[model samples]
Target chain A: MNNIEIKDLSKKYAGFLLDKISFNVPSGAIVGLIGENGAGKTTTIKSILNIINSEGTVKILGKDSKAHEKEIKKDLGVVLDDSFLSAYLTPKHINSVMKDFYQTWDENKYNDLLKQFGLPTDKLVKDFSSGMKMKLKIATAISHNPKILILDEPTSGLDPVVRSEILDIFRKYIEEDETRSILLSTHITTDLEHISDYIVFIDKGKIVLNVPTLELLEEYGVAKCTKEEFSKINEKDYVSYKKGKYQYEVLINDKNSFKKKYGITSIDKPSIDDIMLFYIKGER
Target chain B: MIKGLLKKDLYNLASYKTSLIIIVIFCGMAIIGTDAIYWGSVVIGIIVGMISLSTFSYDEMAKSNRYILTLPVTRKEIVLEKYILAIGATILGSLLGFVLTLLIGNIMNYVRPDNVIDINIDTLLATTIGGLFGVSLIQAIQIPSIFKWGAEKGRIQMFIVLFVLALIGSGVGFLIKESGLSVDIAKLESVLKNFGLFLLILLSFIIYFISYKISYKIYKNKEE
Candidate 1:
């Protein structure tokens, strides 16, 4: 079964609206939720968790999020961008509190995670730096041995070394349980680019694209050519294109086909960042 | 889940150094200050009520509710937990107030013997229950308001509710005066005094239940 499934989910506000967006994370893989600021990544995640009101349904482990939210949440671990408990609380206090919140609460795992993350057990959360706070949140999310881990910007302020370490932890977590799945949302595309098995791109509250990361890395490429060469290429061959100072960097869906048809040697594999930039900022 | 939520709130309240300081000062005043000694349990009740409200403010400051709702707890459970925390704090505060009343009353009577501020057990019981009842009523509306609109916006709602209440009070007074009804203050006081304690307790629970229902609805409908 798909571990996490969001189907036709939509949320509306005065000025913003998350259109009917759908995606799925099959068991045993990490799916990167990529989007720009205000692109409804948080909104979509909130909707799926029933944190906000929405029209469509989100199913986790084949149960509706709203109907069986409490039950569904038992197997779900969440790490939000903002810290969850009072800033006056320490990790020690949280351990005591979470001892009751989760039936799967593991004191040893929690303490070990705290030690691993280098988080001070005595200091108040308010006193911790942003990176430390994020790490603390990640530590809490994983200590419960959840079947699904949903993180919203889990590594925003984290330094590169710490970010990679956290990613490795995620890798190890999934390796530990093949049925475990991860839906991590972040703007730091490089972090996900290395580990994400599938990438879902969201723009203006809509799912612009959803494809396997392998396909994105292997099949997608940028075709850089002169204005004369750009005019010769068929409009249907490229998804979007950016007009550079001298050359036109066109984003194509089938790099192999474009290479075979046009014999373009300038084609290079596109990063998630490049795809996001081309999709959001480049013209069709 | 509710237990977990309350535990977290208790930790938050305990960590608030200023709240701890305020509690100490209030209890200290209850010991030494003559007027404070008379108020006894009421002083401690007010302090506890203020400290309990601080938990809500802390939740907002840290945006903890978003994280909390994602846990295996429902929004109704969250509202219920806040109510329980408020009641728990009130009970703790009442105990402190009651003990302080007895201790200070004895000390003052011992030190002065004559012209002393004496608080009897009956007065302490009456005032402590009365003060807690009022505090609970305010929290009934206040907690729900804070849940619906955040701590800051909820304060404005409280002001509006108070303003509406004042308007109704003035209208009632004006109508009475215009109707040539004689204002019998002592008779009215005697009527209220004669009111059954059981009835008052019943009303308090009813009000609290209604408030819980409202808070549950508001919190349940609230967006993360």
Candidate 2:
């Protein structure tokens, strides 16, 4: 069974729209939701969590998210961009508060995570730096040993060192097989590149690509050639193109066929950022 | 879970314990500032009223509802917890205010034999009834507004509520002076004594249940 299944989901805002989003994150798989700003990644996450009014079905662990929201949320952990912890509250207060709310809350796990993150139990959340606040959110998200972890821009606005530490924590969280899954949304594609097994690229509220990360990299290649040589290639073969004064870079959907048509020069791998930029700019 | 939520709110409030202590001390000063018994009672009532208003505002400013909703608890639990906290704070603050006022009244009585003042059961009952009514009004307006409109918008509604209450008070005063019912205080006291306990209990439950229902509906329909 899929860990999460979002079918025909759509939500409309005044200036933003999330249109007919459908995807599934199978148990134990890490799915990266790649999108540019205002591309509806956060809206999708909010809809899946039933945080906003939406028109469609969102199922987690084979249960309807809205009908069984409380039960579903009990085994799910969410880390939003903003810190929901009040400024006046300390980690010590959070521990006591969580103890009451979560039946599966482990005090030892919470304390260990806090110590590992170097968060002071006595310090108020208002005094925390942005990175520290992100760490705190991660600590709380993992402390319950949840079945699924949903993160929105968990690594944005953090130093490289802190970002790597958070990535490492995510790696550790998904070590268990078939029991843990993650749906991570980020504009920073580099962070998702290293850990994501699947990538779903969304542009302008519509999905452009949804496939295994390795397959995506294997099937598509960014080819660089002179403008004269670029004309020799079929326009239908490429998803997008970035032209320069002396050279033309084309994103080929079928890497193998393109290599066969022309002698393989140097086919560059497309990063998540490259895919997002090219797709949004209608370059490929 | 309710206990945890309640404790969290209390702890959050505790961070400003120093400020709260200062306010309590100010209440103590106001209780002792006036020489007349009626003036002292008015001061105590105003102080308690201010505390109730501040508590509601602080809870909204802190976004306590947003934080609580993220937990595994239900929206119903969140609404019930706020009601519990409001009522609990009112009781605790009223008791503290009563004790401080009684102490000041006794001290003044000792200093001047001719102006001796004593707090009887009637005084205590009146103070309790007035405090409960004030807290109920605050919660009735604050809970629904905050739950529906959020903290920023709710602040405006809070001011409107205060304004409406002031108008009502003045209107009642004008009616008393115009109709020559100034002597009705004795009759009012007699009626209060006869049905005061029952009325107070009924009003408290009615206010809490209504506030709870309104807040719950707002929360259920609220979109992040």
Candidate 3:
């Protein structure tokens, strides 16, 4: 079952518009939203949370996000990339304050997480390093035992070790409950490859690609060929291509089919970042 | 949920406890030998009452409003929490001011028996209430402006509005003086002395209510 179902979601700003974007986060799945900056990733998450007014519909846990915002929010744990509760509040103060907002707030769990993450309970959040602040935010968000965690760039500026530690936390969170889901938005596509069950790539306020992670990683490939060999390939077989000085690099969705059709067995496995670059910078 | 919001603001304000104590002590010492003692309570009342609105600055400092909207609280509750904090602070500040003024005056009088400053309970009450009315009016106008703009821009906007209001007040006073309006100074003083406190308290509540409504209207459709 889908924890969230967004249909034709649209928001318009002064010079930008989030076009009719649609996606879903299924139960027990991590749906990673990947995009460049100002590509509607944050806007889409904001719309789903009802923080911004937008056209179309977002149903969280089988209820309309706007029509039943307060009720739906009870089951949602959200982390904004640049926004949080006051920086003046320590983790202890946050615990006290958050308990009043969530009936199921787990103080012990929060404390344990703080200790686990080595975050000082008394030190002000403003004094924390970026990684420490992010850990605290994640801890607070999950302390309520929310069914769905919607996070925006939870590991944006962290080092590799901290990022891996955070990814482990997410992995363990999903392993802990089969009903819980996560809709994580990040430009760190490699992290998504490890944790996200599905990938939804957005570019310039529109969803460019949405598919299962396994399919995208396994089926998509980069075909490098000589300039003369590139001329014989059908454009329909490939998604996009980048012409190099002496050859052409094409992104093909069905690597096996392309191999059989063109007798070319030199298709290289493409990373999520590679695929993203092909879609964004490659010629159509 | 509002309790959560209040707790957050209160904790933010708690950071000002040291500054608040220092200011009060300094203000108290400054008024020790001065006959303009009534200004002590008024200044304290205004200071404390105005501090409550700084919660907006704290929220802006962390860009917490967007995160706040993600919680279970509704927009109406968010706006209501600010009014509750502002009004609550105003009332508390007024009482604190009144009690401190009396306490300080009596202590000073006991210390120097010859220069005994008369502490009139009635005048103290009037001054505190008048101070409250002034603060309520400023907050009433300021909160809506803050909601329309952000904390920084909203502050500048509020000052401009208050400046305009002061100009209008001066113009009305000028017109009354130039027109040589037949004024009964004694009767006017008598009316003000008798019912002015009641009128000021009533006006404070009325302005606060109107301000709350306008703030809600501005915040209802606001994006953040």
The segments of candidate 2 whose C-alpha lies over 4 angstroms from its true place after superposition are B36-67, B107-115, B161-190
List, residue by residue over A51-85, the lDDT tens digit for candidate 2. 77899999999999888878888888888885364
Candidate 2: the clashing residue pairs are A239-A284, A240-A283, A240-A284, A241-A283, A241-A284
Cα lDDT of model 1 by residue, A1-284, tens digit: 79988889989998999999999999999999999989999998889888889998789999988899999998989999975787888999989988898989889999998998889999999899878888888788888899999999988888998899889889999999999999999999999888999999999989999999999999999999999989989989999999999999999989989988887879988889999999999998
Candidate-wise lDDT, in order: 0.86, 0.78, 0.94
Q: For model 2 chain B, give the 10-residue run with minimal summed lDDT.
A: B36-45
> What are the candidates' individual DockQ scores?
0.84, 0.49, 0.87
lDDT of 1 at B116: 77
Worst 10 residues of 3 chain B by lDDT: B30-39
Position B118, candidate 2: lDDT? 64
lDDT of 3 by residue, B14-51 (tens): 99999999999998997796987887889899999999
Q: Which stretches of candidate 1 lie over 4 Å from their true place?
A: B17-22, B25-27, B173-196
TM-score of candidate 3 on Cα atoms, chains taken together:
0.97
Per-residue lDDT of A126 in model 2 = 83
| Arranged by lDDT, best first | 3, 1, 2
User: Ten residues in a row with the worst lDDT in model 1 chain A?
Assistant: A80-89
Q: Considering the two chains of model 1, state its CAPRI-style docking category.
A: high
